[model samples]
Target: MNNIVEAKGLVKSYGDFKALNDIDLTIPSGAISGLIGPNGAGKTTALKSLIGLCDVEGELQVAGRDPRTSRHKLMEDVCFIADVGM
Candidate 1:
């Protein structure tokens, strides 16, 4: 099956702290998934990156499009309910 979301070597840093470190994620198409972790565990940061609300290093693709460049188009197909989504 194809992936609805794919990320490789994802990283997000805040000042000197690394919120996300070399993260690799994959969500298969038509699958329901969630991120679960304690506070400050980069859950929010990951969501922010996935939804195109924040910028991070590495390659990421959602709905077969890069969230950094094709965010407007990606939003049309993917729905993320969090921070800004609320």
Candidate 2:
């Protein structure tokens, strides 16, 4: 399957704290993928980058578009649901 999400050498830092570094990942189209890690593993950061809520360094793509550049266009396709009711 073609990759729907791709990130290479992703790096994010706040002040002196590095939240992510040199991370590479790929998610193919029509595939089910899961992210598992302990807290502060940058899972939320990565997702936030995908949705363009946060600015990050390195290459990041969603549906073949840059979330940073095409945030307004891509945001419509993303849904955020609260888990409080679950």
RMSD of each predicted structure: 1.6, 2.6
What clash count does candidate 2 reach? 0
Model 1 stretches astray by more than 4 angstroms:
83-86
lDDT of 1 by residue, 7-83 (tens): 99999999999999999999999898888999899988888898788899999998899988999999999776665
The 10-residue segment of model 1 with minimum total lDDT is 77-86
By TM-score, the best candidate is: 1
Q: By TM-score, how accurate is candidate 1? A: 0.92
How far does residue 85 in candidate 1 sit from its true spot (Å)? Answer: 6.4
Per-candidate TM equals: 0.92, 0.86
- Tens digits of per-residue lDDT, candidate 2, 1-86, equal 78989999999998887888888999988888777899888877777888888899999989878999999988777654524441
Model 2: lDDT to the true structure:
0.84
